[model samples]
Target chain A: MKFKTLVRPLLVATAAVGATAVAQPAAKPSPEGVATAAQNVIIDRALLTAFKALPSRFEDAKNPITAEKVELGRMLYFDTRLSKNQDLSCNSCHDLNTFGVDNKPTSTGHKKQLGGRNSPTVYNAGGHTTQFWDGRAANLEEQAKGPILNPVEMAMPSADHVVATIKSIPGYVTAFQKSFPGEADPVTYDNLAKAIGAFERQLVTPSRFDKFLGGDDKALTQVEKAGLKTFLDQGCQTCHYGPALGGSLQKLGLVVPYQAKDQGRFDLTKKESDRMVFRVPTLRNVAKTGPWFHDGSITELQTAVKLMAQHQLGKQLTDTDAKQILAFLDSLTGELPKGYIAKPKLPPSGPKTPKPDPT
Target chain B: MKFKTLVRPLLVATAAVGATAVAQPAAKPSPEGVATAAQNVIIDRALLTAFKALPSRFEDAKNPITAEKVELGRMLYFDTRLSKNQDLSCNSCHDLNTFGVDNKPTSTGHKKQLGGRNSPTVYNAGGHTTQFWDGRAANLEEQAKGPILNPVEMAMPSADHVVATIKSIPGYVTAFQKSFPGEADPVTYDNLAKAIGAFERQLVTPSRFDKFLGGDDKALTQVEKAGLKTFLDQGCQTCHYGPALGGSLQKLGLVVPYQAKDQGRFDLTKKESDRMVFRVPTLRNVAKTGPWFHDGSITELQTAVKLMAQHQLGKQLTDTDAKQILAFLDSLTGELPKGYIAKPKLPPSGPKTPKPDPT
Candidate 1:
């Protein structure tokens, strides 16, 4: 049956569990003639089969994550020296402490210049199909290489210069040999990206939503579950389904066109059909990493929810529906891996290391 | 992006991998004038984010799987005495060796009477959102109880009679007590179902598709991968997705009305909208568990694929496309848990145990 037809039958309107503390939205008199506690909505748990719990980490056999490699990558991720003036590291924009985002509309980069697109949170990014709003990079390894060379970003002149910087750091040289055992030349730019990618790959966060998906119905409040129902019923899941909630690239203005200067993927592909196509951003940690959308034009989560429904699904969401959906999205805020993301002490720069160039 | 529009660009037409020695449909000569090796087709790995690797087991915290309970369930699964005639067991229909199916269109039960519908495979059943074709049972535990008392099935007179039969057997009494510790009387129907459910919970089969999903590009043959692309491109994954490939209840004959005598879930709900609704069967081990469909009427895999496409998707699949999809379906054939499913030696029946009732 179509989702709309089964909606009333599938949902069992019952008193919510563990929601007594919550203010009652619609309280009624009990059989005993006393005001009842807050009511909780219950949807058929079976509908949740559309989602899966986040895996411990997204594993890739090609880049086998080892202790040596992850440690080396962790150091490289924090070392700002990889940049031209030794000022910007991967962590500078994708800050580990701040849920892998700097919480900026567009990230500040080389020489305090701003990037064109919003920097997405690196958390759970390994599970994404592709990286960036335009999806130019295929995997984490390929994505790690882009920002380092971009003029407005890290501003490293070339791969050789980046490799030389790492080679000059005596500690990184030893770390590289250990990380990539038996390699003829280990301190290459490729290995640097690989090491960084390996670390980023393990950056996963487990949230309350995962607990709910893992068969714990009590993990989410009744309101949150209702909000989830609203989100699903609204067809947000058309583009936002899966462990990461959203990873597939989709047409931004699918039903109703939005006013936008950026052509999105069309700027890269130069194909008319590619116009306004962007990778659907993951809803994981979405509550934390806001200043929303490709251009970070909408700061309020409520506005983003309403516009998405309007432009993508051709549905108008009431303020009440948007609020409920926000409550559901708030449950997606995950606990970060504290020890795993801790900033490590970088190795000392060698005497022969290139001096910082302000140019 | 629409899947159809992205298809040609997302897929890179190439030679099939590891397909040598097999007859090639259209083999071309190399520039060196030598016949080329088997060709492999490659699709964008990004599209595969739709699928997830199956977990080792679908864990339910409510009914935890323990060694004692599983062992008890193993014996119960094979014990024919549970049936009124002492001629059948759970394994009589869901044969473990044959991918949890009897290979019959529908199973014969009490007095050799055939059931109304095909007996679906029990493998990976715990991952399903709901149990049975009509989704009458909510979980494996609930599903375990239905056939035991059904007049056409095991045909035990009542739940009390079933409990009394178990209580009479000294081994079962002791086993139940051990499985459900601290209970004053443990040899009850509810505990019996829980034990069986616990055993069934771990009945997972890991397949090559899982390996492919876990970032191993070469896990599937080139033909299999292409077949997967064809499957995805056709939008089969809309109903057949997640770790189990399918578990959701969907409307059968979505685009085209099927010629059917059965009302499916409509019989249970008595609602007009539920006329042709049925729980979408899991595709895991589906290649082995056929004679397919609710009535098992369609015997050939090719014919079933064609009918499903025509009726549900409203698309006519060419013979080549159907054959390619079959290759992909073959990849879903998972390795059965041989050691786990091995029938245990049933305990001796006690003196007061009721005799098999033929009438």
Candidate 2:
């Protein structure tokens, strides 16, 4: 439908989550096109139901967020001293300034070791039901622990090694004490993970799509609204429709076979049905987090979208359809929090701090 | 001569360069003290002539500083695209967040290659007579271009490769144009070095020493003043007395023969006079920019000081004296400009941006 040609009409905005709403035309098209206009209304209503405005925060009942914890987390996030080699920090892989992802196909880790899976954007990741592609870790806190101890990642010798390393840096010890007040010893490995998780929870990114969903009709342009209609019609909303666009588990290469060495969830669970299944990463700041997919094989976003349509939906999209979807996705690029992400003045290492084991 | 017993007196602050200075008693103890005080007067005059307060800026006649160029230089400084592997940058070695060092004995580069020398602190490097430990590069601009192409550093194949890689990122081209206004094309490799140099030239770190040198009598504590006295009396100021503390070139082992595989400046100039000679790095922020020395062989700052006294001055400093000197060096750790060193919002990659060639 030529969306801009149809004048916007006064309609009651739907406030309830998942309730359907549509952009009503000023006047119904002529009698011959009346049926088509009604169908367009149904597609718009589905889009209203499928999408939602971003929430202000993502909360966890088990791991509560606190200002002190978040502040410490910020320092820990930038502290390369956390790594065995004292080179790679959390920011080395999930850079806040660059839409969370390192903008690499695969991130280089301790001793420049490369991991197989691509790093997904940490923006809006707090809302994900599970962390990491394989859903191995149930929450951000659990997910945070894996990398530092991984030989190919931060590469601390062991949990004990990490504890000793943190305890040696006097500034970190003080920060840990302040973050987990009343604890006998707060500089434990678990507390470190919790602090990092708290910081990650605050990394929410909201975009214009959020404003559009909140009933500010002028938030998205006519082309973006048209792109919305196309998205719903093509069933892209089936796997990717929510506050974060996609935060559920889905099978890779559902309809068409994917060619890759990575076994995906099958490698973790050893279950037949779980083959190639992976977490559908949130689409917030998706335009910036590329090359796309679990393997990070795709470089071009349009090519990625086209491939998804063919492999996942068993359908083909026109070049025009791809362009509109891309324009819509561009609206997902949110403003980076200037103050929150400002680089902190990392405290100097104490005399007893261990030197880097760079070998 | 116990420093705590020596009271400060009403006297004109010396304001000369490269003169001598010695801590003197407010009142003469006796006839012997009178002769000592006279000698102290001569030393104090020399100290006034030996050093000057840090200048506000280091202006370059060849390449001037500008707002646009600095802004662009900041992005380039943080951009890892400068490396052949797209995993390293100027920041990788000389991290601004950590007192302009990786805090590693030596930095890890492409494919986890380690350099033969320690990465020097970039802070106050602009004021140095020459860049690089061996004084191979004449200035910051010349030194900026050496790393990316070095086999052990960033490991880019050639200058052409770096130019082509930078050109691929569309945002950098626009930035280059703005930074080098009136030029038909400014994205050349030479301009790349210039922009980075401009950013680095602004990395001057002035500490409490500057305030003391500026005639603020109470700027340094009595102990710090005593430490200064000890530093001067022990003849440590012969090579390390200046705005940057130690920016002049000096023989690495003047009084004692040193053993090392590296030939220092002899490897660069192949002259006998150049043997064991190296550029004396700035002592500003030296407490943080460790492990000390060209080989990064010394991890503790005081040990480095003690070794210098033993080898260069042919003197064994008492534990008390070394402790006092360390306290004074601690005063050299300056405040990091939080806003100026904050991470910048880098421009997004263009469609033409090349993929990483990890091999």
Candidate 3:
């Protein structure tokens, strides 16, 4: 059987499970059509709510997008010599060509060792309320330095070491001076993170969904339009209605009764109310980024949609409703930048040493 | 006391440590300056060797420099969404602006966890006989995949998963088709590594040292010239006389008697003779790529030089000799490609969704 056919039945089975859980005395679906409509309403509301929680634009005012800073930050981002080991660079993860992700469930660092969490995309991170799923950092600048200093991340020892290291490179020193002049140390860690964050702020991809949201009726297909209706009627627009849909923080179990082993924000805030609270992810490129969630537990978008409906909306969804919602999610994919498809210039080859002369 | 004054005496004291380890049976101080003469020999040999390692300029290469491939790879290199946690990227460790390394003793990976060894510079890795400290992989293709699949490196579960993840990205599918056509699956893990490896091959750096090796006498300063003489006169070129300076594998304890926990190639090959054997790293941009060696035990260039003299060459290097050698090494720094610096375009901001909208 084709992949879609196999998936269709699985979706129905899961939806059936949801239907059985929500069967109550107040109302029962006596007809197949009524059951289908009820399921569609549940799925649409849950997804729309998640989508409505995203932000609209790049919010950082101080290091706003400038052609120069972004250009400089881009170079710094790809330069591998930034780590203690010259092996990895920013592109090792969050590959732009791959919708800003490396597709790894977890990342490896300096010595080819595994890390704790999945790498997030910087595509629309400028709209995030805070960085990281746990919300340990308040902004991109604060978020930028965390990995550079983390022993398992970039493994840079200290800010002074980073500054001294950058100063030695005449090209970097010049760039830093031009980017941030008059500062005692232009190449300091603060400036480095700011420069990177500024560059990240420009990674804005506008998808077909945006075109449709902006009132382009023809931008989406009939199925996708139906999916859009389902998405709104089920109350998904409540949380995921923003420009960069779902970049805010939220309690994961607010509508869902599920609990994850990871404490999420509770570890950072030490508050019971903050338990399982995670930064709501952007659904702009949701269809492309999977295995889903911070732990990457959910693999299929259809399964995730069904789970959300039964748990979050306390309603059951059918396979058709889930499929339509997924189609709408797929429409959110955007076009990459013009030059985003090119390879980087490698470092230079040095002088060759001569062979030893035999006496 | 001035910083120089305090450091000068301490340097002399350390010089004695080298003197005791490798003293010639009969030694005489030359009137012309023993250190200067020794420096020139090392520089001359290293320069000649580096020049010969370059591929013939007239060799017709199929995949010549292109705007598309390089730009695509560049974007992939800096994008951080590749990791499971969405926090780290290749640039997290191997930063180009920082001399193709982050200058950390070890790098961090997933959640601020420590990696095993120092990150090597990606610069001129194309010219190395083998990749990594242990010379594990035979070429860049093999080496590139090592990190992506390594539990501690990119931490990708499998190549198939990697392919599926990237295939979800439409723009990537287009780029992969252009880069590699007629394949059943163009965005497979092997192809991804190949694309990245192709980009890495272009990282060849041409330094001032290369100019000098190409017969440009004016490329180096007098102190640097003096250092080159000392490098060869003291037999520093015995093992380091190669295109990559020291990319060939060698035993670590060549001179001084010291034991290390790492068995080097022996661990990989299971051959007793390969114990403590490691690939001699290229000296290109050595000044920028530090804490030095397989274990990153040494922090200072002078200290590293002294240790190599006493252990590898079985000779004592004076302070002046060490200083001159460092100057010669520094000349290996080179400029990155023009327009290598770029601005990354971020994903667009969607409509703003409220933090706790219960719609």
Candidate 4:
């Protein structure tokens, strides 16, 4: 199906060359990153129509969200006792307080070992088509089980150990019973993932960009609107679209080659098509997240913008254009849910709980 | 559809890591590129079940290949009247005498202009899923119409001009009538393409590998079999499978980043996922098709094999391994269909036929 529209009747190659000619040169933004009165540029609202406002919750029929499950999941998310060393939790890397990331190039895990890829932010991740840099996981529930047992991550040893840890905590047992009522036995590993996934489902953050999409044009500044127009004109929306601005998997470099040690999805799939293919991270609160790309090699937002244009869009963006795009990206910063993400009191470990295994 | 299998249940990433660890090291072949008695390596024929022997003719229901069409197409394929300057034809670049390639990194076209990408061989091309390095053309019929009108290639002004030229040649009219039979108007541009496509359909060359695949174990040397086994074990079969050893679109670099100016399919599609994606060239007559890859930057077959291992397979192939793979590739060199592809006499241009325009 991907090859369907490409098989044109005639003159497709010529038309493609025309497109390359038109889009190769990025439009120069006015000084101060604002549209000049002389310029008189009016960006069509339809260009922004590709994007949708963030939902209140990313609901899944398989794992329905409940107040009890959300609360228990929040506790489990922050519980360090789930790890082999009883030091690292999901929060140790994806800290919800800091917009769901520890801001490390690669997250430190068991024995202070680093992961191969940069730790992607968890905020707005439930809305993604798939999870992880390599897209190794399908959804939040499926992704929740990986790092807990990874040798370089939480290093919990086994699913049985994780289940036993939860069961040994009397408070968690009661919480699980309430969360999964009518089930003869609770506190199972699968149910535990479901609970954490339920909490993650509500991790949406709405921003001024969403307000603009909701017909509140005045929510964004004039410069930001100019930047938005630039974003659309440069064809950045081809990959970075949808509710989260980006969630689908796309190649790292589109126009110019990008040198990266990590082969992304190819490392997992071994399929030639999957090489350098990575899930496009959401732009929501992008300004708050630092060290961009799969390797987190880029530190400056302007540099990231410049590289994206050069490598992905085949455009040599002017400094003003990069800054304007950065201004537009800055508008994506949203207010985090304070009370919803607040760390809950973890259940005390029972006498039967296994001690932290340093080995 | 692409995302289906990727949404795994559990332990997918861990298992993927295991695969990476195991396959990262490419096996070194024997010093003499032959299987040693001590090595005791027996290549199972079943491992090559993915590949099928080359068909006699790549048939298409749309354009049935007949003797009349084949003869007419042979003339049209070699006729220089198809170009604006009357100096170039399909054979100008895809020379039939040289395994259907000019051996240039990129072909010199209209007014000595060079095309952006390498000109792939025409042999076994009819069996490809799609045509062109970017796969813009669906089949040989569609692909036949491209270069003639491309400004840098044959550079015919328009389809109408092409039709008028064919109509002017009295001998071509008779040939077209014979080729088309019941058609009221036989000398059209579409029919011209169909005629050329019909000629190209029978371009398949049967190699010794086909004999080996047909259960003739002695058809291949022991060294070739060792190379074939190495090819299978190195996971070259992932993309380079099927009858032609390859015919699908795959990322140019699956394990390591390959720096290339040409963005491949992305230059046309402008989709982020299409970046660095190119149609995998068939290995049917691979040893004969020199100056490899989309850009044709690589010259030696050994270097190309080594790079494929490093970039696509994440393997550091030993010298012996590269040589062994080359030996296997040599077995793919099939005998050319000399009588079938023999150039036919083209009809003389009529007085009313348009003159070659240099400007």
**TM-score of each model's chain B:** 0.89, 0.86, 0.80, 0.91
The reply for model 2, stretches above 4 Å from the true place, is A1-46, B1-359
lDDT of 2 at A194: 95
lDDT of 4 by residue, A19-82 (tens): 2222222432346534551143344453453477899889999999999999988999999898
Model 4 lDDT tens row, B145-262: 9999999999999999999999999999999999999999988989999999999998998999999999998888887877886676555765576678776666565333355678
RMSD of 3: 33.2
Interface RMSD of each: 18.1, 37.6, 35.2, 17.1
Candidate 3 lDDT by residue in tens digits, B260-313: 566676677654335556777778788888888776766787877776665443
lDDT of each: 0.76, 0.70, 0.59, 0.76
Candidate 1 clashing pairs, residues 3+ apart or interchain: A16-A40, A250-B1, B15-B39, B15-B40, B16-B39, B16-B40, B17-B40
Native-vs-model 4 lDDT?
Answer: 0.76
* Residues B42-112, model 2: lDDT tens digits: 11222332455777667798889998888888888888878878888898899999999998888898899
1 versus 4: better TM-score goes to: 1
Residue lDDT tens for model 3, A59-119: 5877765665666677777866566665566767677788887767777876776767778
- Among these predicted structures, which one has the highest DockQ? 1
Question: Arrange candidates by TM-score, highest first: which order?
Answer: 1, 4, 2, 3
Q: What is the DockQ of each candidate?
A: 0.08, 0.00, 0.01, 0.01
Shift of residue A287 alpha carbon in model 3, Å? 68
RMSD of each: 11.4, 31.2, 33.2, 15.5
For candidate 4, what is the total of clashing residue pairs? 0
Worst 10 residues of 4 chain B by lDDT: B5-14
DockQ of 2: 0.00
